[model samples]
Target: MNRLNMGRACARAGLSLVAMASLSAWAQSGAERLALAAAAPRLSEVVVTAVRAPQPLTDVLADVTLIDRDQIAQSGAVTIADLLARQPGVELSRSGGPGTATSLFLRGAETRFTAVYIDGVRVDSQSTGGAPWEAIALGQVERIEIVRGPAAAVYGSDAVAGVVQIFTRQGDGPFTPYVGIGAGNRRTGKLEAGFSGKQGALDYSLGLQRDMSRGHDSHPGSNPDRDGYRQTAASGRIGLRLNEAHRVDLTGTYTDMDAQYDGFLPGLDDHGLNRLATLGASWTAQWSPAYSTRLSVSESQQRYEMVPTPPYLSRTRLRNYLLQNQWKEGAHTFTGTLERREDHLVNAPIDQGRHQDGLALGYGYVAGAHTVQLNLRHDRDSEFGGQTTGGVAYGFAFAPGWRATAAAGTAFRVPTLYQRFSEYGQPALLPEKGRNVEIGLHWGQAASRLGVTLYRNRVSNLINFGAPGACLSPFGCFENAGKARLQGLTFMAAHQVAGVNLSASLDLQQPKNLATGTLLARRAQRLLKLAADTRVAQWRLGAEWHLASHRWENAANTSRLGGYGLVNLYASTTVARQWDVLVRVDNVGDRSYQLAQGYPALPRSFFVGLRWTGR
Candidate 1:
């Protein structure tokens, strides 16, 4: 089918799903709805990344999503990127299978535009301008928070598109230990163990995981050998409650990954090595009922290298310090923060370092039916003088379980050190800036919910590779020669019917480059997702459907990437009073597709695992 016909078909399908959801909601009896609501667990009611502080989900004015530990386990995803791609307004691209180069686009923005944090500690690569998603182990994460819009006003830089925060397990209650083992196709295997507990005034949690796989050939046209990978990861969190008003916390994580891939020289064996480590420490004090303060220090190290014939190595180290104060009185809350960030990069002939000092102020109000939030921040960079950003949001609860929200924000991202000092760099390039506005209507009651959001974000001073002129490389030079407009409408619905939980989301977007009047590379104009889950006897079963419209492979719109659909299924059950069993199958149809031009998507695969928890 042609692109136009495919797009129309997707649109019709989306409409049909929406209609079905509405009809089901209307047909449900009041008693059934109430029963569904009563049975629902209040697991994810509070989120912190939306406003840099913990707030109830209903009071938040920004677009956000929360994923709990149970959701993570049920996802049956091999990597963090793979799980994130299942979310609305998010997309993923990979050059190969697990433990390979990967990119995530939030709201159709570049990977670097999204700021990522692990346990309140920032992790980024100055060489690539984004986090190393492939190196981060998914088994160690306990919770995830995603904010889906520009947030430079809250975070200093690298937040033009959104912000993502990952949290490791924290200890509570009595001592608990768990172990899990799994095996799958492609000679894949995994083993994980963890323990968490709180004793007296101290709490601690630690986990370890290892994974290995003989993956498929990523680039079949080049080398025919089976690409393989191995990974090892560990995470720990410890907290000390000195007193009722004072506390201290420490968090750390480390991961090492080695993957074999086809290089330029086909016959020879080549490998890529990646390592990441992060450490953070913080202290908090509550002086009074209305006042509190926190101080934190964190550092992250990232290194990547290619072996043998094409020897290459790059390392990035980032350090952050923050002092925060919060005051609360009646229905108003205020915050003041002072932060410092230092970045250092070592790549071949270039070793560079830079620092930024920032001050931020914020205000939030939640009274009766009205909610408001405002934020302002200023950062002085060692190389680029100063940049200021601000945002405002307002929400009004007009009726029972109905709310209207409007928000506008400004964001910016400074050029990476490698983008300035490398062989293809340009020292005089300006920082990229973004302006965004959005409005949403949401209604929620019990187990039924609906939301519609419309948004438009424009970016200026965009950077692209152009003809060689101001750099040492003859092939091309980095230049600020592009502009982009990303506009979209998203619809989401959730309803329970006949003991089954149903959810659907549709995203219609236009991510276009103004310079060439064409669609951005690897971004679809339409996306739809549907999911259903139910429990029968002793087993819980779930299925997911994912669909996307056609996309362009390049900015010129010369090459086309066909759209595809995939079905995934998962089932879990508990037995022997202490063991949990899970089975999952992905790409059920064995459909052939590609995320990148040359790379092939993973075929139909199955995995089964057994986990035991000490009671």
Candidate 2:
């Protein structure tokens, strides 16, 4: 069958699956719902990325997902991108195996549109316009918070799509230490160790990890040799409590990776060396019962280089300083922040630096059955003058278990240094701007929940490479010559039936260029994800299914990439009081698929690990 026919069939199948799941969830009796609710554990989870302040998950008015340490250890994912792909309204594309060039699309927006932060420190590449996903070490991450949709009003630039925050482990409770080792197919091996403890008024955490893998062939047509990767990472955190109302924190992380891949020259061995490092310090003081303040300073550096001939090297350094104040009384909350960011890039003949200073204000109210949030920010750029952004959101609960929400926001992203100072650049390029509006309906009864959201985002002054006329290079130049519209409907459901817990999500979206009327490259129009887990005796078993419709390989939509489906299974059990064992099988059917045009995805793989904790 042709790609178009196949795409249609997949869409129909996804719709049918969604309908069946929704009906099954809604068909449960009131008694069953109550029983499920009673059996479920109550968690008072707090999130900080939604409005840049700590708030209960139940009180936030935005779309968000939180992944704790337990989930991360059970996922058996080799990279951060691999783990994020299973999230709702998110997709990933990679050129090869682990540690390869990767891109993450949030809500069908460009990878560069999303902002990334680690331990409250911003991390971005001025040469590429986004975070270096390949260089980041997932093993060092203790938790992750993802906020989907524009957050520029709270975080200045590079938040046109969303924001991702990664947190390292914190010291708490009694002293504890842990060690883990694992091996998998293709000669993959992993070793990790960590310790955390609290002594007197000080707390500290330290961790180290090493991983190596003999990966599969990335480009069979060009390089027939096996591509492999080696990585080493470390993380540390320290905190001191001076008094009951004052505290100071210090955090840092570093990682080095060497990944082999096929370069343009086929006969020679080629490798990509990547390094990432981040450091941050913060001080918090509670001056009054309802007022608090915090001051922080952070820095991050990223370096990338190619070995042997065809030498290439690029480095990016980012520094951030912030002062934040919060005031709270009963159900009313107010926040104000002053932030400054400096960016520096060095790539061969190009060396440039820029700075942005921003002031932001936010207000939140959660009283009775009503919740509201308002944010506004203004940034002054040394190179581009000034820009302003704002957002407003509201939620109302009219029934016992039902809520309706609506939100609107504006965001912008400044042009990357490479787009304005490199060989093929346009110094007059303009920052891309986006306007978004969304509405949602949600129903929850303990462990059982159902939600539907519709969103429309329009972006103007989109930047793309065009025929060279304003640059010295003869090839092409970056220009703001396009417009795009991203509209979508997302459905999510979770329920407990018998002894099994189930969850599902479906996304139907049209991310298209308004100028040529073509779908965005490598973005599927339909996506579906499903998972179920249950406990038997001492074992916990889970299964996941992922499906996506066909996608276009390029902007013209003439080159078609076929649709595919994948299934994965995992099981974990306690061997001894202090020992844990986990086994996972990915791509159970050994299905052949490709996330990019020339790169083949991994085949069926097996992995097992054992961990021991000292209490």
Candidate 3:
């Protein structure tokens, strides 16, 4: 791979200081100050995924994106996949429409390289090492933090690409209730209702939602009949403050989905039943203003049943225990965590189980215009023995609103159950290891923010299913015989001018196999996202556009999926004191596209809904 040179861009960015200085002077003259005052209040924007604890985004050294509740509701997105498609340094591929199998590639890395978390608990499947992105409903999410780069030093494994953490919704302020209903193309319908409240020492939130859609043909040539999907999801949380320095919390989520799909060989009416459930409890205590500790436990289960000939059911369960402590003294902070995770898998074709234990240490220091972070961890897996990872990050502020950051980290991923214990399994396969480095620049003012990041990552000891020499033993077996490299640059910008909101992001990447110099599969070299929103009178109008470059569908670059662009429009307005209406048109141009080689994307569609907010 050719080396990347960013000298010219860096020089131009540095030259912008003159313009910023002039703008600063003009702001001090008065009118700009009033404009800032009239602008909406900014959220604190504290992020926890970067450092494993809450810290202001401005002080973090990693490239991170924050998607808050208001943005979720305003985006007119129904699933996590819809919201993630527009993010920087991310690409998605779905086999079909909603509730189907989906894959997320981060910074040109494979789907399994990323680790997903919900309320500080890992949610990826132990059998496949992939998260059920389709089943994670947006209705239960309060916020999402997407941290790009390696994070195995703080989290254990499968964090080579990045870490995506989701915080569930909880009650705040006085009692409030909400309900919504919507209908769209393809006989799609939705119903949702929720209530939230907080008493003197008790806080709680509950939500229920259901959706059904008669989706278009997944593979037109094979099956012309429409595939259908139905899903029901529920989430709840409760917290009790026993005293001023102690608290207890409980949270849970459940989702069930039934989906119809076409088989690879044109078998129609291929159906699947998917179910997921997660429950967690935590106890927190503050030893003083400077010290705190938390103990938590969580359990999660995932099941999938395929119906038709040769029907089978696969189930995986996980139980986790965690103990964490944090201490703050002057300009320095210290943290320590000990965790144990056990995974149990049951399958008609294969049955297996595994356990892992890990310990981590972290340190952070903030003083004047300098910020530094350090982390180290050691994990012992029942099958892979022990491995260690670590990282360091530093940030320095040259001006009031301008800063530069550099980070480097190492990560690893253990082989999945299917890879180790199945019929074609190779129990001797080793874990995959990765190392990465990145440099970033951030500039932000009143209503404007810009972030730039350049990163390179390399992985070795990668496990693959087909190994010529080794496969001879079992006809096809897993082996660690692959090495890959990913290099990329990400640019993100957001600005609020007058009453309009504008945001854009671009990603350029090179993903290659070191052995053959072939491009990786399903990873686009170029991705662009643009969005604009403005409020006129009492109505809010928004538009979004996304463009992706052609990508290879096969690792050898044999089959390719052409690039495509899509546009969407949204409008919302208040109908009454506590009632609001929303309308959205997706794929406004009705363009034909494909995320996968043979699968077809959704066509132009429209939806409208009414929501009531209780006071």
As for candidate 3, its clashing pairs are none
lDDT tens digits by residue: candidate 2, 571-598: 9999999999999999999998888888
Q: How would you order the candidates by lDDT, starting with the best?
A: 2, 1, 3
Those runs of model 3 whose alpha carbons end farther than 4 Å from true positions after fitting are 1-43, 265-267, 467-475
lDDT of 1 by residue, 1-615 (tens): 344764575567556655765422211111122223333455226778877876666557788877779989998899999988888788888888888888998889989999999999999999988999988889989998888888998898989989989999999989999999999999989899999999999999999999999989888888878888999999999999999999999999999999887787888778889999999999999999999999999999999998976998999999999998999998999999999999999998889999999999999998877889999999999999899999998887777766778889999999998889999999998999999999887666677776767788999998888889789999998889899988777777778888998877777888888887888899998888888888999999999999988888877899988999999999999987889999999999998888888778788988998999896
What TM-score does model 2 achieve against the real structure? 0.95
Candidate 3 lDDT over 1-615, as tens digits, reads 344344444344445432332111100101112123224244335678887776755456666667778778877776788887777788999888888888889898878898887776677776666787876777778988888889999888889988888888889899999999999999999999999999999999999999999988987877677888999999999999999999999999888988887775565588778888888999999989999998999988889887783486878888889898999999898999998988888875667888889999999887877889899999999888898999998877777666778889999998888777766677788899999998877666677656667789999997766754553354678878789989877666656667777767767788888877888888887787778888988999999888998999887899989999999999999999999899999999999989887789888989998889898
Q: Root-mean-square deviation of each candidate, in angstroms?
A: 3.7, 3.7, 4.5
Candidate 1 residues lying further than 4 Å off, grouped into runs, are 1-18, 22-44
In model 3, where is the ten-residue run with the lowest total lDDT? 23-32
User: What is the number of backbone collisions in each predicted candidate, taken in the order shown?
Assistant: 0, 0, 0
| TM-score: the better of candidates 2 and 3 | 2
lDDT of 2 at 331: 95
